[model samples]
Target chain A: MPALRLALHFIHRELRNRYLGSFSGGLWALFQPLIQLAVYSFVFVYVFKAKVPGANAPGYIPFLVMGLWPWNAFAEGLARATTAIQDNAALIGKVALPREVLVFSAVAANFLLQGIGFCAIVIAMRVFGVPVDLFALPLALLGFVQLFVLALGFAFLFAAVQVFVRDLSSALPQLLMLWMFSSPVFFARDALPERYRGWLDWNPFTYYTEFFRAALLGAGSFSLSSTLMALGVAVIVFTLGYAIFRRLNPYFEDFL
Target chain B: MQSPVLVEARRLGKTYPKVFHRRDRLRALYRLLTGGPGIDSTSVLRDVDLEVRAGQSLGLIGENGAGKSTLLKLIVGVLTPSSGEVHVHGRVGALLELGAGFHPEYTGRDNIALSAALYGLNADEARAKLPEIIDFADIGAYIDEPVKHYSSGMVVRLGFAIVAALRPDLLITDEVLAVGDESFQKKCVRWMEDYLDGGGTLILVSHSMYHVQKLCRQACWIKQGAVAASGDVFEVTQAYLAYQERKSAAQPVRQDSPSHAQEFYLIDLALNGDTADVPLVIDQGCRVGARVHVHSRDGREPVISFGVARADGTSVYGVSTEMEKQRPLRVSENVYTVEIEFPELALLPGSYLLRAHALDTEGVRLFNTLVRSITIRGESREFGLIRLKHSWPAANSETNVAP
Candidate 1:
């Protein structure tokens, strides 16, 4: 219970840290995603003439919104959580607490904000006659939760490693970018050549983006096997990441 | 009944990996992951055994790089032991460094919440103690301002205030008293005394032997990653002070070799028949005999003076042969010896300097000086430099004493 309380405190602190000095405050959490959605919609729909590869595909804006919000949460969460321990070296050195709380709060704070933005944008698309599945929002949140677990796994792994290898945080942005493009964040998996389409399944993020599109926008069909696979991957990654974190936890102060 | 042991360590040790290059970090990471042999490392602390019971206070005394801080960190669980084990029971409130665990960008109020959380206080409990902590910190409006803009003293005040409010089972502090202002320091010392009186435990690391002696009943002297001495507060601190005095005296003396060109110069000074550079450790109330041999450039008799001063240079007692209308015995043509003895030394237990000076016949001008360190070893709760002889007449009358 204390660890849970500490984690919540840190999550609150993290959320405040993001919007403390900003002009628009927590509104930026909602507006930042909206603006990003606008820009991506412009560049991909208006400029590249990109489209969903199906006859009854949802509008390009809704499809993009469904995937981009989750991708932003995953990428941004990983980026912030990777530096969680390194950024808090001062706190870690002086105070004795569960170090996992720091990484958890970072990833959780990002997911919370983007999760809110994802729901808000979905409802907005529904109001604009885009035919978003309003009744399936809770189901979509389950997929979002699954993605959160996956991101937390990577967060733990990267946060521990970043304490030793300082270059991981520096190189994480480019790596997340490559990971984003490799998944179906901007383009559909079917849009990839037939041979390369199978490779998309290897990226852990591929299931979440495709799942969110299938759940919220009704663009793709959901498969039970894929859901089971995603659940297994999340659990395995979480266990492994947490195991590594616990192993490296005691040594973090030494390295820092 | 004996109190429970609040802290127990068995041959505790800590070492930091020597990561000079990026490649070494990777290698160390690999070694840690694979449970391989340790990477190249420097051991800061090793084989330190310590035990402290509930309601007992222990002072850790050491030089700058002497591993006292590392020992504190290890006990506080901020650092893991590399070789041995340390177990601390109950909640520990630690102020390891000035403004430790404080985010510079966060306001003092916010940091208080963070610290409370780190100490495992729930939100309601933290809220309940907020006003008390802020009041104790007494930084005025700076509580709401970011800690970055506060002075070092403010940071220490805030840190101490939070720890005080926590009222943890065991309080471990490292030199936090040295930073506060005079009144705040008095307040903190008073608070610590009260905390201890309430049966709280304490482990303090400080260079101030005075504070250590005042607050702690036991002391551990660490030297170069090892326990040089550990025992009674008075004894260990005296030993530590003697060691420090010897270290400082080991430096080259400024005075040139005995030169007869001056009007008066000292030939030698002996204490209790011993003439050596190391300090003489003696029990309190022991007879102390001093002999000063002076060289006179001229045949004129010179005045010899002896003075006892606390190690910090506060003069305790000084006397001149001229003051007592006594003259030195002329042992030779130019050499004179003055012997003085205190049948019962009244000085309390602490380190003091015994100085011998040669001055003009009138005792107007000092010519040469020689200093020797003397450490008084005893167990007494008595205060001040010299223990004044007094009698408590009220003890004989039952009515006069409080029931």
Candidate 2:
């Protein structure tokens, strides 16, 4: 409880400082993703007539919403985490804390924001009568949690590296943008050519979006094996991220 | 049994890789992995052995980048030593730099809780002490305002207030007193005195030797990543002060005036055998002697005189051989040397200037003047340029009647 309380304090501070304190600042967190959703839905659903492969409906908006929300969380969390140490350079260079707190709190703040976005989307989807599968809700929650852990691992790894190679922070968003496009948020994995779909199978992100589809819309190939595989990848990423982070922890102050 | 040392650092050294390019960092990383020597590096701190027992207060004195802050960081475990280890036995609270741990966007109140948590206080404990911390910081309604809105002095006040409330067994502070206003600084010093009085250990780093002498019993002067000197506060601070004076005075040596050979002139002046090359530092009540060598065109005697003044040029005492009616003995055909000695120098602990002059025989016109700076070093808290030797007489019973 004490640790949780302390973590909550940091989380609260992080949220107020980075997001919710100012009117425009609080608006940005919600507006950014909503804008992204609007743009992507406009281009793919209305313009390209992108089809949902296994949805109860013809439109892809509900399908895209399920996956895009989680991807946004993952991407935003990692982006924030990448600069966790760099952003708190003043604090990191001084007072001693479990430096991981910076990374954890960044991810937590993004998760809270993403969680709110997800609920809002879900309510809208249900109101629109897009077949909501309550049964797969637990699996969807598991997928989101997996994404959080996976992002945390990457956050730890990049947060350490960003201190040394500051270019990584500026470079990450481009890479993440490409990564988001490569994952199947606008189209189903099957919509890609067979060869590209095979490559997508190797991409861990594909499974994350696909898992969310299964949970929310019950419209994707719900493979228990792939779900377990995603879990394995999350654990591996977290471990590797933590290892790199701890190895570089002592050298962090040197660069600063 | 010896009242366990609150902090001990043994052969502590820290070297930062002189990374210039991305390749350099990569190579350093490779070396770290392969156990290879760093290609090029700078030792910011090296072989610093220090200890502070419980109830002992030590001051770290050094010029900027002399590793005083680095050593304190090592002792506080903010930065790990590269070669050796620092063992701190007690809970340590360090103020390495003002607002270092504060989140600028968080209100002062929030940062107090957050910093307390960072300093190892549990949430409940931090909450319990919040009121006291807020009261000590004493910034009023500004406490609820985001820290970025507060002034730098307010930040230090908040940072220091948390440390004060925590009251760690060993307090390590680096120039925390440098930022705040004078009144706040006095408040902090007063609090520190009380902390030390309550049997706490302290390690302070400051450019002000006066504060070092006031608060610390022991001091260390770190120079170029090594312990230049360390011992009693007065001795180490005096040595450091002397070194600074010498470095600043290393400007071009004064050339003899072109007309010196045509008139009576002072060729050289030395204070207790120390020339102008090094500043003189002497303890109060210590013997201070000035030797002046003068030259005369003829074997005619000139009035040799010298005076002591505060660094501000306020004259403390001045005397001339003419006033004493003494004749200078010629050491050579045209050279004369006079020794003016103060068996028990009465100047208090402060920087002062000593000027010796050669005047015409009638003492009406000055021929040449040579000046040297001296520091009277002592641990006394007395004010004034000179320590007057006087004692208070006990009041008689008759005089004790109610006024």
Candidate 3:
């Protein structure tokens, strides 16, 4: 977070810049998650009568948020960061700086909005039945560590690739959609077949989403091995991604 | 040494490729699919080397294709050299494009933060400088409004104010000052003077020689992607001016007239001072004489009207003598001579053009003329706008020395 201070400032400026005259105010940040959560909760909890997978699941509402909230946050963060350099062609080409700053800022901004949505769910759980677990609070910090690294990796990869092959921009939504269903969003990860379960084990989002749900549900149930695996993957991907981006980053303005 | 040379560029060059299409769009498609060279990205700058010390101002002057702007981009690192390097020390806050970091949808307050962030300011640091920047920008209530609603002057003022408030070590400014009103331009001049007085370096590029002479101590005049002259401001400007004059005189001026197949018409007209051997300033009001070569259709005298025009191609003053009262004094082919008088010059410190018109002695329409590109240096600042004449005071005022 200390390293990302400049990045976060840029992110805050970017949010204000995009929504400046829209009249939605702070509602601009809360709108997308609220609507998406409401619609999916109706379809799954009401229509399908699905039960919460955790031991002390508050109710359908909190359970529904615990699943889709992280998925949506990761998806939006990746989307913004992926196109960050390409979308800001003017700033990238005209202004002199490290272009990675733009990508980090874009993803960081979307992550903050999603963070707010998660806080709302925690407040709702307190009002209803589920109690707040203080021990789970520190565990949630570990969740963000993974999310931050994942965002950096994807943003760096997409930003470099998008500069050359613009087709990535048009093809991203389909890719993100596929990634969303893979995470334990609408269904529990345990329900999948044993062989199919290995697929979620390797996917980094699995660790983050499951950890987020477990942290909000209660403490002691959170898995340490999965979070550790997530951190390892983040380290490898980010280091490789930064190496590639820095090597190719010099000529971005030339082609742009 | 003198602040240890803040910026240095050696053998810098940039080439932009050009894209062109044939009569068929399919050819464009073929090139697009095949990936071949286009019209742009041609080498605009070649082997340019420069050194800039802190607090040393340099004026960059050049023609449209001379690569002045391309060099600026390279210096600011907006562009990387096709080959070579630009070594810059300390922070470089480039005002290359005014409001370059501004988002149209964002308020002025937001854009200031955005620009500050681009300059490597943290959120808290940007917020700390916000009040000073807002006050300097001085648009009042409009600062809370989106920048799209701001006028060009407001945009320029805000941009200038921000840079001035957060003065960087080396400030690179392009020709952005021509955006505001007269008073605002004055304010900019004062601000620039103060900025320099505070030991800040400024590299300015402007089409106005008045500005260069008034501000820049050293100047570089570029032509044809090369340095034509570089030295003191006045000398470099004079060399640029003299080069333009020589090149213009080398061209054969062609008058573009209606080509509807009319009778014999005029082809070209030129004005020369009677004292061509000894040059004179326009303030002294030299005797302007002209030579006109007329090819007539029939044996008849043609009356001619001549004019002195402003530099913008608008005629300011004109005179025409009576026509055919003295008819039949004519010729068919070859050149003729026309002379005009200017007892006094009535212009300011700028260039002017001379255009001529020809008609029959009876004032019947005959021919139009080709205008010559002319240069007229005005009176020095010691005199007012026009050469109204002046004398030194007997005691020379505060000098306490009498002539």
TM-score of each: 0.94, 0.87, 0.80
lDDT for each residue of candidate 1 in A120-230, tens digit (9 for 90 to 100): 888877888998889999999999899999999999999999999999988999998898888888999888889899998899989988888888777887799999999
* Model 3 per-residue lDDT tens digits across residues B1-403: 5687888988877775343433223333233334555424567888788888888888889777688887888888877777778888877777766666677777898788777877877778788888888887678999999888999889888888777767888888888788877887888888888888898887888887767767777888877666777877766875676566555556644556633343335544545533231222343355556555554556345667767675556676776656323232243443344556565565545455666666754677656665665556533442222355657665346665555
TM-score of chain B of 3: 0.72
Model 2's alpha-carbon lDDT is 0.83
| DockQ score, prediction 2 | 0.57
Candidate 2 local lDDT, A68-185, one digit each (tens): 8898898888998898888877877787667888899889889989877787777777888777775666666767788889889888999988887788989999999899888887
What is the per-candidate TM-score for chain B?
0.91, 0.78, 0.72
**Among these predicted structures, which one has the highest TM-score?**
1
The TM-score measured for candidate 2 stands at 0.87
Expressed as tens digits, the lDDT of each residue in A60-167 for candidate 3 is 666567767777667887887777877787776556766778888887777777777777767766766576664665567567757878778877887776665567
Each model's DockQ score: 0.76, 0.57, 0.34
Q: Report the C-alpha displacement of residue B301, candidate 2, in angstroms.
A: 10
Predicted chain B of candidate 2, TM-score versus the true chain B: 0.78
Report the error of model 3 at residue A51, Å: 4.5
lDDT order, best first, reads: 1, 2, 3
Candidates' lDDT values, in order? 0.91, 0.83, 0.70
